[model samples]
Target: MPLHILDRLNHPLWPAARAIYERSFPPHGRKPEALLRRMLERGQAYVFVLANEDSQARLHPAAAMALAGPGGSGLIVDYLAVDPALRGQGLGSRLLDELERWALERTTASALVIETEAGAGKENEGRRVFWERAGFVAPDGHVHRYIWVPEPYAAMYRPLPGREGGLLPPPSGRQLFRWIEGFHARAYRGFREEE
Candidate 1:
């Protein structure tokens, strides 16, 4: 499988990739496809897919991921999902590896940051574990609750590869939060944080 950076929204495999994205996250957790299109058009965000090309040159997309930044100190993994039938095959980790390489080569992001649900009883522990295995770290006892979403979320980060392919220390929780907040303020204008 090869990782594809989606520069045009109308690519042949776009619908399939978008389907994977829509089904992966709940309505409250995802940005509208329209917004995504606008961001793509304006180069405000990036979308990636892992796919296979068959003999006739058609693409079969297996996973999709969207990202929001290297802006204001954060590179947010806004959404990521593998096809439901393709779970446990390490496609997600492959995608992350490709993404990290791409970011390292093309951008100067401090780290790759993501938000995972942290509320009790939310069945998100496995999700957190997956991130941990991919080298993301979150501070213990810290959760950010948004007003528009009921579940509390913890921000986790994997430091980008530093000079000579070494890993830098992860960014602080405050820096991670700022990156997420700055991106969301522009991308999710009406949403606010819980006081």
Candidate 2:
């Protein structure tokens, strides 16, 4: 019940959600707010916020995620954040549960992809483990350099419909470039939409 789906970010809970996002992600991994706002306006993105049941709708979200389906398909979980104070209470997992539900039921995305920083550190390993527990598997290959960061990230994916064909066939070379462009291009597209 705390999972509140947002049509746009200009809502009472935005400050809380923004604060959590800022705190959860490092500077380089976070997207520009302007870019996210524009994406919402163009109907290319979806947002969901989680507020503690006791806090109700007035307080900022305890967790939040911003997922985008570029070109009317291909789910990209661009951001997922939980309030540092509220971490380890299973709130993050709950948020992901809601996110996956939306993508699988409300949208037609064939696969859900999450790009994670590649590393050998425990923190990085822990992050991957969390996703793995949720049925996500890191595909074999380097996805790309983070848009703002200089390191290579892995494109981990989970086929949402829960079958072999639910996956996006792995891409290579020119196909990989096109695959990456498909989602990144939408981020740069103008946000104009008819009323």
Candidate 3:
């Protein structure tokens, strides 16, 4: 199915997007709908949905991702989920690739960041594998926890297509450790008041 992506979580798309989001994230994991709208109004949020582009009617949402782009950069993968029935079809990876492309083409983002549950536990093992297979790099000894999320998570990054396949500031690679923590503290400030 052809996908239809919307930069802002606006009308003619909210319903389907909402369904996917609601199903994908738990209560604390999701911001209030009103908060999402406000973020969109302020240009701090982006929602992309895998829609049936062929139809004019409200398209069905197969997969969706919500991003928080602070300062119009440091694109954070707030949440990503595929329709339960559509899992194992590669839609999630495709959607993520599309989001990466969208961020590169439409914004000034330097990299895409996602916080995934990490550890030897069975719960997070598959999640970790999925991200790694999708081209994300998780550094050793570099991990963090979101304020609202109780579990320890590791940061994964896929730099946007840049010069010589390096970060724009050229500092991330040279100072990878500092960049990860700094980005997390700055990007998730609302949830991490003190970080």
Can you give the lDDT of residue 16 in candidate 3? 76
TM-score of each: 0.85, 0.80, 0.76
Best by TM-score: 1
| lDDT, candidates in the order shown | 0.73, 0.66, 0.65
Q: What is the alpha-carbon lDDT for the whole of candidate 1?
A: 0.73
lDDT of 1 by residue, 1-195 (tens): 777788667976678788888788778777777777766776767788887666523444545455545555556888888887777988888888887888888877767788888865646888988999999888555778888777788888877766323323445566677788877666655433331
Q: Which of candidates 1 and 2 reaches a greater lDDT?
A: 1
- Candidate 2 wrongly placed segments (more than 4 Å): 55-61, 71-73, 141-143, 146-148, 162-164, 168-181, 190-195
Per-residue lDDT tens digits for candidate 3, residues 66-161, read 554533235677678886656798888988888778777777777676778766787699998888898877645555655666787776776777
**Could you give the candidate ranking by lDDT, starting with the highest?**
1, 2, 3
Which residue pairs collide in model 1, if any? none
Over 1-195, each residue of candidate 2 has an lDDT whose tens digit, in order, gives 467766688977677778887888877666677777777777867667876656543554445545555432457777787777666877767877777777778777666667776767888778888888877776665556546567666766666665346444653333333444576677776644331
All candidates: CA RMSD in angstroms? 4.4, 4.0, 4.6
> In lDDT terms, which candidate is top?
1
lDDT of 2 at 152: 61
Model 3: per-residue Cα lDDT at residue 157: 70
